[model samples]
Target chain A: MTYTEQLNAFYKMVSDECVQGVSLDCVIFGFHDTRLKVLLLRWKGTHEWCLPGGFIYKTESVDVAAERVLRERTGLDQLFLQQFHLFGDAVRYNREDTWQRQKMPMPFESRGWPERTLSIGYYAVVDQTKVMPTADFMTDECRWWEVSDLPSLLYDHRHIVEVALQTLRLQLSWQPIGLNLMPEKFTIPELQRLYEAVLGRSLDARNFHKKIMGLHILTRLDERRTGKAHKSPYLYQFDRENYKKALISGNLSFV
Target chain B: MTYTEQLNAFYKMVSDECVQGVSLDCVIFGFHDTRLKVLLLRWKGTHEWCLPGGFIYKTESVDVAAERVLRERTGLDQLFLQQFHLFGDAVRYNREDTWQRQKMPMPFESRGWPERTLSIGYYAVVDQTKVMPTADFMTDECRWWEVSDLPSLLYDHRHIVEVALQTLRLQLSWQPIGLNLMPEKFTIPELQRLYEAVLGRSLDARNFHKKIMGLHILTRLDERRTGKAHKSPYLYQFDRENYKKALISGNLSFV
Candidate 1:
């Protein structure tokens, strides 16, 4: 469908039910094969791509809108989503310029598009294996893009992604990771690789092991993975009680 | 002036120039006399208090709006302000109920006030001694209240302040503090007191001193504070270069 046609389909709800001048964009982060990936969607009838975002209904909270947006795209509800930042520059998106670039008609303020829309940016960590990517009405393609290599995103989306990643990286100091990205039973090296991908740098194996162990938020299982050429590493899972405690206390001392 | 009269004077500018359904609330935290204080304002002709907040102008970014709001209330510009959260529940402020409770006439949607508004919450660390509080057109009084003992705040402001302070406390894990809250020359014990005030708990003086020294973010001047009966303690100021580096790197290892 053309951009106008697609927008016309939901224009009423968008104008009346949703709050004007306020929307939400989510940076959905997924980890797989030791590579950090972000979910992006290709705009329908266009080559441009952007983060999976949606508008907030007058009845829904910003967080609820974020979760609804994420669920609509990922086919998963109740992921570990967090509101990281708000992108509210007056020139974040020039409507005329953006429409010209997209080769779409400019509906202007008459179509409920505010001159300056403030976006609440939320970041979520999910296991890539579980997400069944689905496209929304405005997008034709929904897939993961490697964080290190991304398409030239539309408007201020590139900056938004950078801020989201930076927020996630800094959050590692206070919040425990690998809970959503890792398997229930995984080895230390696998966990370290996840951390390395998220941090965008390698850590000393010894130091990483010591730090993760010191937190005591993980439980070493009696079982071990077999079929490796080398010595089988012991499998471990998050100590749910301790992990929840550390999260609530916000004192997880891992870098 | 009454609430209606106060809002009427700015209604034209607010309706025409400001972004609808979006506002900014500042949790301005100040440390004084071993207490953490928050700057609040009393609504005109009402006993209710709330965080000093303002709406974003159509031409201004949210950060700029926050800075503008902070400057208007504190009479100080360029504070160490940080956006921490967005409070956007539909029930955050029930306009009709709020007006009835405040014993004011409900202007409803006719005024600039929307049924639902999303607030960008920013937390600022400032030296209380440097602030000269000023009331705005909508408020009659502006001053500091010890966080431990606060009046019933309007709308969701009490919750907003809690979230801001929690964010500030968690931020101490990675971000250096006291630069904006402390005097130019302060002793180690004085710095410790500042941290204690923010964290809402006492710290071991020896341990705090050791940790702070290890961070190398402070420069011990060749001077001592000599106003007490006890031995004078050496005065120190933040090492500008190191402090900036720590802030940018977000790797400060103090809590």
Candidate 2:
């Protein structure tokens, strides 16, 4: 199909089934190489990046709509997706002219976008290696950027990202959901590094280890065998059953 | 003005200023006499009760709308309000006939409520004694109901209340926001009763006391002087400065 044909088809699809005044923007966080990252997308002809987002369908629950949007963008399913906040500022989309400046099709006004919108904010933690980020017809690139070093984002997404990070930090202090970012087996230092990245501070090694071990939710695995290391740290795996039980029993502090 | 005149004025005001597709429902929770209660309103001429709620104005944020609705219902400002969930099921208001059966005015349909609505759920903790619970033209009565014994509610309000309770329970495990429901000075047993009411389970007195005191957020006060009591239990006040500090430091576990 021609480029204009594709744009018309996209607009038609959105206008046909999408709910009038609601959208979902996802902050998909991943831990890789001891750094916390978030998935972002660049519109086909724009340098500005944005959180992967889409409109909610008329017949779909907001939760289902969020999950569908995330899966379509990341090609990963069943991640820990949570709704944290809703952004409904009156001027949330006042910068539609930016798309026109970028020489891209304007999806908002062209398709009779609702005069006002309430965008539901969802955050997900995923294993970075498992996701193969895909770019759609409207996206030129899709990639993960370190959370601490994000580029200027479109719309009010920068505020959304900041809030998502705050929510994740608050949630991490009480729940063990951060384990979703780790591989099947990881070293103690690796786990600590992930915490440090999320908390944006270096923790005392001894105190961190003591606190994590006291939770009784990790099973020690075989020692790492890196030849160049001074002394390889021991690897550990989350005891899924105990972790589930701890979550149910509550009061499992991680910070 | 006559009743019909008042109804028409209310509807006209709502339609004039409110956004078309979004609404805010507040689950105002209060603790009194060792029981957890929720503020509910009875639609005019109907027995059904519902969370005190209102639609967002075209120029207002959802958060502001929630706070406005809450303050209007409770006659209090700046309570511990937080957004918890969004209800967007396709059939959220499918039972419109419930209004017809009661011969009640349909504020939603009469005002051209959107084909689909996405109601944002906010939960607030307020001092029960401070609320006057005023009824509007559309409401015949407004009162508090025990969380465990709520009457039949309108639309999807029953589900909204259940989710609010769950959110409150989860939040109480990590934050000290529940102090909003208590008097300025309270006894240890009184605070424990609030926890018990929220959790719906009796906690061991010794364990509950030890855990609460360990947080170091309360200041001991002069003993209560109840004339008929076997013993006067000492009153305690939350150290407002330390409580604020603890909230900022971010690990004030209460449950």
Candidate 3:
């Protein structure tokens, strides 16, 4: 089907089976090459990029809807998704110029939709090696962009991304990071790099190592990383039982 | 106006000026008499109680709408309100028995509202002494109920309260509690009781005092509480500068 045909079918589905005026945006975080990356989509007929988002169906809860969107885009399920904030600014969806730039019909105005729409923002951390990024009918590209160097996002999505990162950084003080992003057996420096990426700053290596060790959630392996040039560092992996206990207690501190 | 007339006017106002299917609920919390309390409203002409909530106007943001609701209900402003979660279950508002129990009209069915309504949940901490609780047209009584001994709430409101309290307790690890709940000058035991109230558990007195002092957000006041038969304890006030810094950095760990 053509772009216009696909959009028609999408809008028809939205009208027939989805709840109006309620949507959700996902700021998917993945750690790759010592940098935090976010998943974004480029509109099918335009260069404009936005966070992967979708409308809530009338039958499913908002969380279920978010999980479905994640599964559709990443080909993965139950990937540590959390609701962070609700973006309900009056003019969040009032972007006519975006449509004109894409040369596509305005979805809301044509359908006599509500003047104000609200979006629930959710952030997910996923394993980059396991993801098969797929674009839906409305977008031509689905890929990861480094958080530090992102394109001009559509609507208030940039603000959404900023808040998601802020929430993630604050969450670091209470929850362990890189459980999904780290390899099963990795060096301490690898995990530290993931924390630095999310925090957008470097940390003193000795201090970070001490703090993480004191948390008692990691299990140091007998072997080293093996491929390093000089003094190879010991490998560590999350002790699943301790990690689960810390998650439920929410007492892991890493500042 | 009569109750039926008030209902008609509220529905008309919602249709004319508010965004349909999007609302907000505020879990107003106050610390009093060594207990954590939540502000709830008793529905007019019914025994049912629920969290104080209101609709969002098309011209306002959700936060602003929440503030408006708080101000209208408490007759006060500038409370420490934080958005914790969004409740968007498909059947969250589908309780037909509630209206049947009230022997009143089902407003949504009468007005053809959306099948799924999403509510943004915000929890606020306020000084109980300063509030002048007031009821709106739909409610006849506004009062605080001890969190441990709350009445059966309407719809899914009991679940909302549970989630709000859980979020508040989790946040206690990263943020200082009792900034709004405590008096200007308080003893360490007084503040510790406030923390216990929110966490629903006890902390060792020496451990809590040591941990709170280590955060460096309080100033040891020379003044002591008078009019006590026992040895009076010294009072301490939160140092605003340090509290502000800790809040921004989010590194204050109490657990």
Give Cα-based local distance difference scores for all models: 0.85, 0.83, 0.86
Q: For candidate 2, lDDT tens digit of each residue in B1-255?
A: 977678777767766778766778999999888999999999877787888999888778788888888878888897789888888777786556666644555455666555677798999998898888987777889999999899988878999999999999887866776469988888889999999999899999999888888878898987784775578888898988888877777576665
> Weakest 10 consecutive residues, lDDT, candidate 2 chain B?
B99-108
TM-score of the second chain, cand. 2: 0.93
* Tens-digit lDDT string for candidate 1 (A1-255): 766776776776788889987778999999888899999998777888889998999888888899999999999886799998888887897677666655565465767666778888999999888899999877789999999999867778889999999988878856887788776788999889889998999999999889898888889999999997999999999998888888888776556
Task: List model 1 lDDT by residue over B1-255, tens digit each.
Answer: 765776676776788889987878999999888888999999777888888998898889888999999998888886799888888886886666677656555565777566788889999999889999999877789999998899978878999999998889878866887899887888999889888888888999889988899888999999999978999999999998998888888777655
lDDT of 2 by residue, A151-252 (tens): 968778899999999999887877777568988888888889989999999999999889889888899976774765488777789998888887777676
Using TM-score as the yardstick, the better of models 2 and 3 is: 3
Q: Taking the tens digit of each residue's C-alpha lDDT, what string does model 3 give over A27-127?
A: 99998899999999998778889999998888789999999999999998967899999988877754777666556765655765666678999999988
Q: What does the lDDT come to for candidate 2?
A: 0.83
How well does candidate 1 match the true structure in TM-score terms? 0.92
Clashes of each: 0, 0, 0
Question: Which candidate would rank higher by DockQ, 1 or 2?
Answer: 1
Candidate 2 chain A: 10-residue stretch with minimal lDDT: A98-107
Candidate 3 global CA lDDT score: 0.86
Candidate 3 docking DockQ = 0.64
- Stretches of model 1 off by over 4 angstroms after superposition: A1-3, A94-97, A204-236, B1-3, B93-97, B219-228
Superposition TM-score, candidate 2 onto the true structure: 0.86
